[model samples]
Target: MADASNFIWYELMTGDPAGAARFYGAVVGWTIADTGEQTAGGVDYRMIGRSDGGNAGGVLALNAEMIAGGARPIWIGYLHVADVDAAVEAIKADGGAVQMPAMDIPVGRIAMVTDPQGAPFYVMDPIPPEGGGESDVFSVTEAQRVRWNELATSDPEAAIAFYKKHFGWGQEGEMDMSPLGAYRFLQRGEVMIGAVMPLMEGYPVPVWNFYIGVDDIDRARDAVTANGGTITSEPMEIPGGEYAMNAIDPQGAPVGFVGPRK
Candidate 1:
């Protein structure tokens, strides 16, 4: 059992699988390929490969029925847990809601859940491969990999408490954002994985924003526009002197990128 209850995998749920594959492939420099596997309902699934030849995540093609049932284009991260069912029960007890009940898949047991603030993510108990190894889907400085996992919620205090209780997370420190609120950094063990901040007025609801690392910020910005994506936020210098920006893909999924300006 993977005892580390941190983000291990990510998946993008999009209506147009092929188009999304192309869009992200160009923007993030990821190699997207068909897994040749389909869900029982025939929805296609593709693997997102990083430049390092490791698995970054996956792209799940949402079918018509899924879309009609309220599924939208979004990127959801999966947190590895010791037991999926137990995590689900504990989450529910703490005011979280289960979007999809725990179920067994070829790789492991997984369940979709939403925090009290309505931010959705997944919990998984993975069946390790022949040689047990950890996932490197997230990295703070690697290009073509997830660099950060940020949560924008209506209630940051409650959100912090919930994650800390469930995942053994901690608030290391915070940066004052003035009128917006404090940006509290989330620490899993000793690594600063991400942060949580109060959701601003413009956002309709709470959501998790994953920022993918790139080699060049300017090149990425150009690719996003050229590939039919909209830049919601222009690239700005972050505390670490790196640049980060938010954007919406052609398929309407929110995404972010971080890197140097070169």
Candidate 2:
């Protein structure tokens, strides 16, 4: 089992699972594998596995009903918890809203929820691995793994407080973005996982964005454009000599890719 409050799984709800599989497979070098899993509604779910053979994330094809109900393609991270039901109650008490109630599945219990600031994510208590504990799916320097998680919310202080109380997250460091104010890095234990900041003007809504690791930043950016995705910005150098870019996948879902320039 993954440590409680850690980000255990990531998932993408897409309108075109096959096309997404193809696009991501090219850009991120993941091997999209059908998990042979189906939801209660009979929709198929697939896994995004890394080249080194670890599980990365998942993809679920959106049905017409889901699309009709305003389900746009987006990626959501799943935070690990010990008890889904108890966590749901605690979140509601803390002013968060339940988008989907906790439910039992073959893998474990899960619920969709939004923070007090209305940034949405999932909380899950996944089934134990057959032999024992699960391996880490996140790495600071590994290609094809999740490298960072970011939140753009209406209230950065309140959002940080909420996460700190519920998920045991702490502020690792801070960066001043001047016009953008402060960008706060969030850490769970010793791992610096993500950051939180105020939502910028003109953004549609407060939400979390995750960055996937890549080996070559320029080639990954090229792969994204050639695979029908849009690179919203030029690759920029980060503090540690790595490059990162913001992009929208072919389905219009925003994602980031980070690595060194080749």
Candidate 3:
């Protein structure tokens, strides 16, 4: 089992759940199924399944009330913690804010929170199903799984420190982006999970970007355009020799995909 501070789940909160589902299904090769279960506020939740029979993430249908409350389409990752309530308090004490109070669901207790720099994510104390092992929603080399988790923040140093303190993440190394800033890699024990970089110019606010893995970068890029999504950044080779690209889904949510050029 992955201890506290690991990303156990990923979720897409979108206004058009069906459309977003189709887009991701085609691009990332996921099989999203409606669970037919209504959440506390009557929200429709769908489960994302990878081709290998493992779970990928989930899709949340945002209601008009949630949108009226300033909710927008977004992809958010969930970090597992031992105690949700304690984590919320630690975050608040560190100048972070809670978007949703701690609440218990079928899975476990969860609370929506933002880092001090205002990037939002969730903290969950999950209750594993009978005999179920750890979650493999995040992977380094598997298609349809989240390959990387990047944080674009106004204060990289502070954000890095905050996550390190709460999640026990360590800054192993970094890549220099020159004028933009350094891209500091974050690791949990031996796993190089993600990185933290300066929030680039023109982006209105700080945010977390998760890159899902694909088999072919070009094919995925084409799928984005053919399915009504806009390519924000063309595929570019990264450190590990794989290519990565950014896109905005039809409903205005920013997303990323990484894979080989072929």
Candidate 1 segments exceeding 4 Å error = 1-4, 34-36
Question: Which lDDT tens digits does candidate 3 get at residues 104-212?
Answer: 9989999999999999999999999789888899999988999999999999999999998899888989999999979999998889999999988635789999999
For candidate 1, the C-alpha RMSD (Å) to the true structure equals 1.7
RMSD per model, one decimal? 1.7, 2.0, 1.7
lDDT of 2 by residue, 82-195 (tens): 899999999999999999899898889999999998888999989998997865777778889989999999899999989988888888789998898999999888878889
Off by over 4 Å in 2: 1-4, 34-36
Candidate 1 structure quality by residue, lDDT tens digits, 34-143: 45378664768888888778999999988888889999999999998888999999999989999999998888999999999899999998999778888889998898
- Give the CA lDDT, 0 to 100, for residue 87 in model 1: 95
Q: Name every residue pair that clashes in candidate 1.
A: none
TM-score of each: 0.96, 0.95, 0.96
Candidate 3 displacement at residue 201 in angstroms: 3.2
